[model samples]
Target: MSEPYEYWLLDLDGTLVDVEWDYVRDVFDTVGDRLDRPFTDAEAETLWHGLTGSRNRQLDAWNVDPERFWTTFHDVEDPQTRAESTYLYDDAAFVAGLDEPVGLVTHCQSFLTEPILDHLDIRDWFDAVCCCTDETGWKPDPEPVEGVITDLDVETTEGTGVLAGDGACDVGAAWNAGLDAIHVDRHGPHQRGHCVRGDYRVDSFDELDLP
Candidate 1:
């Protein structure tokens, strides 16, 4: 029988939002241009992954504030240019189709989260959004995952709730917080040996048929 669930915890990037890495590439290029050390495409890709892993760490390394970094990144003067440059996943519209209450759990910082949700006009679909900030710790640590469950007031067990996301860390976080998991493989590759194993796997939300 399918496991029953009362709440759904969703990841934002790669899961709900299809962020164009070009925006990140452009940012890195701009930073490199200002620093006068241009990065190759390969190097930029490495930097992008590194940044994703080390967002909180970078704040401490650079001795700069997290909020400040986000403010600068999202402050493009032309609104249309920013909207044109950013993107939400084509399947994001399906989030509203969920029958149960859904909460957002993302490693993305608040400044980026709010604007992207506002841009897509889907902020209301989420019952709550837990973002990484100076106060909130990153995922795979269980703090943020626990926060989401607490806010949602969902039972945390094998059949009460499921955390769905696109990365191994998402699975780790869900397991750590005592919830079942659904792993979404947005990209083609699946790192089978990693910490992220799932109760169910799907390419898109349309394929997700949670009980």
Candidate 2:
């Protein structure tokens, strides 16, 4: 954008920070063992990174029990450990400097997200943190983002707002909510297996030329 947004919404994991491969593999290993179905590395990557686009859709295709898997995932996930494993991207530092109202609208639940934000010491960067859930709906649904918008208390006219993230779901949510989307492509096309279209696409926040 030529100018800064009136208000901004951001995704958490993948967009700001990500857990290590060892952690990802470890989590899946535990979940798979419990499910009695080990996941291949490709499957793990696809699910973890949303490379296939929608994790729920992928799980459905594989006949995985969504409720059971998520429940197990929640049970096995260690908030402190995941938070300790998370690291902020170098380019993502600019978000802390943003002058306008900023909100976090993410699929990361509060149990995990709170620890991660505290771990990174970036909790103060957001005016509102809307952790997506059954009630609020996930990204690409626009409901959670709208909840964050309500929390930020910003009036938006067309083209004056934006949401940035590292997923197609983020783009969908942005457009669906009538805001501009900034697609931060952390994983290259070859790795992700496809491109995520958006009003703006970048590999790094350094490319935004924020001032």
- The C-alpha TM-scores of every prediction are 0.76, 0.97
Score each candidate by Cα lDDT: 0.69, 0.91
lDDT of 1 at 63: 59
For candidate 2, which ten residues in a row score worst on lDDT?
A: 1-10
What's the distance in Å from true for residue 54, model 2? 1.5
CA displacement after TM-score superposition, residue 19 of candidate 2 (Å): 0.5
Question: Number of clashes in every candidate structure?
Answer: 0, 0
Best by TM-score: 2
lDDT string for model 1 (114-134, tens) is 777888788889998899654
Model 1 CA deviation exceeding 4 Å by range: 35-37, 46-84, 190-196, 209-211
